[model samples]
Target: MPLNLSQYLHLRSVPSFRTILAVSVLLRVGLILYSEWHDAHSVVKYTDIDYRVFSDAARFVLHPTEGNVAQGPLGKRLGLGDPYTRATYRYTPLLALLLTPNEWLHPSFGKYLFAACDILAGVLMHTLLTSAILPHADAHSASPARDTDKHYARPSTPPSASPAASPTRREQLAMLLAATHLLNPLVFTISTRGSSESVLALFVLLTLHAAVRARWAAAAALLGLATHWKIYPFVYGVACLGVIGGERGVAQGWRGLVGQLVNWRTVWFAVVSAGTFVLLGAGMYAIWGYPFLYESYLYHVHRLDHRHNFSPYFYAIYLAYPTHYVPSSEPSVWQRVLASPLASFGPQMALALGAGVLFGRRRRDLVFAWFVQTFVFVIFNKVCTSQYFLWYTLFLPLLIPQLSMTPRRALQLAGVWVGTQALWLSEAYKLEFLGQPVFFGLWVRGLIYLAGHAWVLAGIMESYEP
Candidate 1:
């Protein structure tokens, strides 16, 4: 049976922005209480060591450890240490600087700070959805007069009896985006665990927001900072460039590329983006020298820590080169090059394929392409961790409004995503924390995760009513 007008209105009203914020604040308070009590049963008990690493690095930044020049040119320590005091920190220097305030304040300040960032991200999601994405989605369904006024006026009240006065599809979607961020389990987990992905996620959304507004310099600068924090964000450049190019009505050929290259916004974007990366890199190198550069940047290039990572490509790497799975065994170069699995080439292939897709849809809305780009970025990454979902989950809800699926279909797709994650985590936890021969189970989980995303992507593509 079809939902009646009142029933649909009730569903729409449930995810109102005010309701989402209230629930979010309450959830954060609960997390804070749980954190204060140090409850073992709390979900944060299985917190990622990445949080501790951030705190330690920031602390080191606040107070440098004394050492000799023999370690490196940077005075005492060769690198920042982790929770166990191991010299293995793996983030850019800017992140440490960003978190230093948490160190200066109370020990628990960092968790609260991350929680605040998550809230900020939700706000940004609301703005992006309502101002940038939703208006266009509504334009297709409503009269031009209503569409133009949708943003200028406050959200229209739910329809009384008049069908024309009903809450537009756009308002419902904006609420959905906010609700998804506020209630997302992954956001809660990452915030409670002190994952720095919160900070990165904020920058990512801000960059998209800027891109949507055609504030090219702001978009580029934000993307640069985000890319500096994590190399994967470099792929975001494609979305920004593609969107701006399309907006300007740049043609789909080499002539368009040439024209866009000379555009003032394009030139400004390129300059600021490159300048940020170079200046930051130079400043960090000046402060810490070779060790800092190697530990922060080069380490990732050679990182082969294949222990319990959630990448779909890992299973192929494990099967083809089983010796890499052996803690004591070092795979030969041939094994790494020839026998290594999907992620070995996945990023490049995904980027290429994504570029093709985005460029082909050169006339599609920039926001849609941005979500697609970032989603592909995280999915095909060499190291897919639980926290990595934050890279795109916040953006996916914003894109959902544009997809031509019914509410039931949307719920079903979300179920596929969440169900796959639940199944994968069940097996992953067994292999990661428990001593179980769940190696094959990990493979199954990877296949399922990969398939789920593929299905979601296909649905989005197929449902492109625009």
Candidate 2:
């Protein structure tokens, strides 16, 4: 006989990272088996678009002299710059170099590599949460009675409430953080879809781990690598300073903070971070030339992909600035200035200003503040994509142990986030795959996404208030 509902719930609620990781592995194995049975080894002929693109680009990296590779299709250009020789290769050279095994061997190898990175990210998240953040949060939230429980729990204690049987706070948080990343549908999609987002996610979690452990140079180096992989982690610079400063108890005032920043450790972090960027960038330039920088980094600096994107800013640009709906490769200087806001400059500026104000408030919990910072960075981006959600998903679980949200509020937030994503993706599927006209519905979906994410950010700020 099958387990009843209560039994099922009891078993499911067990705080076991091993169980979560096992389920994650099973899901990944299914995806890999499916690919193998289909013999889908080539990039272009594969099912997942991003994976296909990554494989194709990796092929170019493996054999730069190959003359037969397609120069990407027209009208599908998302980033700016000169017409790319290999138009589909829009990511950093490091990513191409990383994906070379897919080109040299089989695409299945690439899928497995990404799966490994996905699992590695979960491991790093578990370590960060269980070893560091959870303990710190527990200490902060623990009361005298809670801390004294060990000493007071004798037979004379009268067995208060049957020992309050439940998983300890640390165990619950460890399972939650591990399972959130490992079992997240979005994480599975990106990993099996063959996107390098998993690699980026791994580096991000590692960077945070290093930072929390007071290994500033390691954190800075990892941050540099992450920034090269995806430009968004540049925002983490502010949060890094905050973390280091908070560690040194420099929150007395701005003057003390400024004085602390001039210390040797901060200088070392800066030197190491800049040195990493310079070395990696010089290597890429030598391998792929200026076009690598242009296509990969500069292109994204002014990118505006209105097609099938869910950014509210891009949606407004589509409806209001139809001429600027699709980006131009050779936009004039005047056009560039006029399109800055739609290109995400305006919102980025607003985010920078907001970060300044928040920092001024001297929020001492640097890790939690950094989580909020990264969350806002993703939500306010102009070119928000489906995979972009992974940015916060990686950090949110780490931050959860620190948050004070009630069970009801947490449920509401989770419901709103998942519901909005489902609704938006439903419309997106109709437009991209089902051959339906969803232009108007796209606007509605964008609004819903914006509102949902905005609500989440508001709640985070409220919970993490200084």
Candidate 3:
């Protein structure tokens, strides 16, 4: 018999589900209000404040002809002619364009704009994960064992052993993903702040979704915008290219890979992406003048060498010999070579390329490869700030349904999330203890925080098989 619509509605309207949804909405609204209030309280009354540095940079790009930077003309009026020196401000011209409308509003208003973007990004993430995981669950007829197998398999497939399956298990998986997205502190914080991380994350999710659907042009365009906002997203193209190539191979698994990449759509995406980047760059140069653009935009890419050495290995080595070692001032040839050693690069690239080489042979493995490639780049980079966690946050939720997660593992992840929030809030509020050493409390909290993250990352790697 067909299920009654009224009955289904009654079941879904159960107190638990409705209560959870209500709580999620309340938490989101509360975080947004808190962030807005915090920024307002921190305001310097008649004077402009220096927080939200990225937003300020965006405003500068939007009004380059006015000889302004991201912080606005208020800086000039206050005789603080150069805000760039006080903050690291660099953003793509496209992002600047997005912030143009907000530039006219008060900085507090800009905070709201950022918070809105965060909420939208979270919604999109939920939708993408739902779409991505539902098919596998349905194929298993809602069998938990089959669902578990599919989660860990390379090329997830329907159980030929049982053709007549149900949708109960699929519904369960969707609920879990929704719960994770709603409760994850990292996601909550990013969404509520006036930061570009959430927007970049939205673009990342869009790019991945487009790629899966074989919408090459749309994917490429989304990727172009993502890269323009932050350069990290561009590296994902390497993984995508690998997938395309792998789809064409046969005996060597080359046939399906070659066919996917040589298509007209892929070609169009490439062309559009190149053109978009060039046009955007040219526009910035024209408005800001080459000198200002070079110093502000180009300089960051060139100056990455001298930044803090944030890799685990670097931190370990530095701590072992604190007084003897000094951080490099710029990217010297040796520093670049050491930072991205050939040995590490070769293996990482091989894994990405190899995943492409074996594309349809294992669908689950391909996603894992892409995740590992991105993770390695971020974790081993020359600078590892707390904010850098945003990159991992962007993709980790998508992998939850695909991994062999246990209740224990889930609890550990929960613990790590809570620890991260405590550390982040402490840092954000500049909380101090007893004022013995001004930075003492922060340093102790930071060490504990990094250790917690390291534990979670290790757990993830151990759980991964492909």
lDDT of 2 by residue, 163-276 (tens): 222235355557766787888887886787677788888887788788777788888999888887877776776666655655556455667767655667667777788788
TM-score of each: 0.80, 0.79, 0.66
Residues 1-466 of candidate 3 have per-residue lDDT tens digits of: 1111111223343334345456666776676667666656876332123235656655554444334433333333332222233245555444445655566765455445555555555565556655654455334333434224443433333454322123443344444555565567766665555555666766777777787776767777787777666666666665565555444443343565566555664466667766665666565555444543655456654343322223333433333332434555444554445444442445545554443444323333435555665655655554566677667655665665455555566677768957765764555364333333224444455456556766776667655543
Q: Assess the local accuracy of residue 261 in candidate 2 as a C-alpha lDDT between 0 and 100.
A: 54
**lDDT digits (tens) for residues 1-466 of candidate 1:** 1111222444435566877888898898687667667645665554457766777777776664444122334423444422212256777767666677767676666777788888888899888766766665555433322323322322333334323233464456567668778788878777876777788888888887787777778878888888787777777676565555556565667777656545676566778888887777776676556766777777776555456566766655555456546757786675667454344556655764465345433423655665566666667766687667777666676766555545575677778988888888899888778878898888788778878986986666555434
Task: Let me know the TM-score candidate 2 reaches against the reference structure.
Answer: 0.79
TM-score of the candidate numbered 1?
A: 0.80
What C-alpha lDDT do the candidate models reach, one value each?
0.65, 0.65, 0.53
State model 3's lDDT: 0.53
Model 3 lDDT at residue 46:
20
Ordered from best to worst TM-score, the candidate numbers read: 1, 2, 3
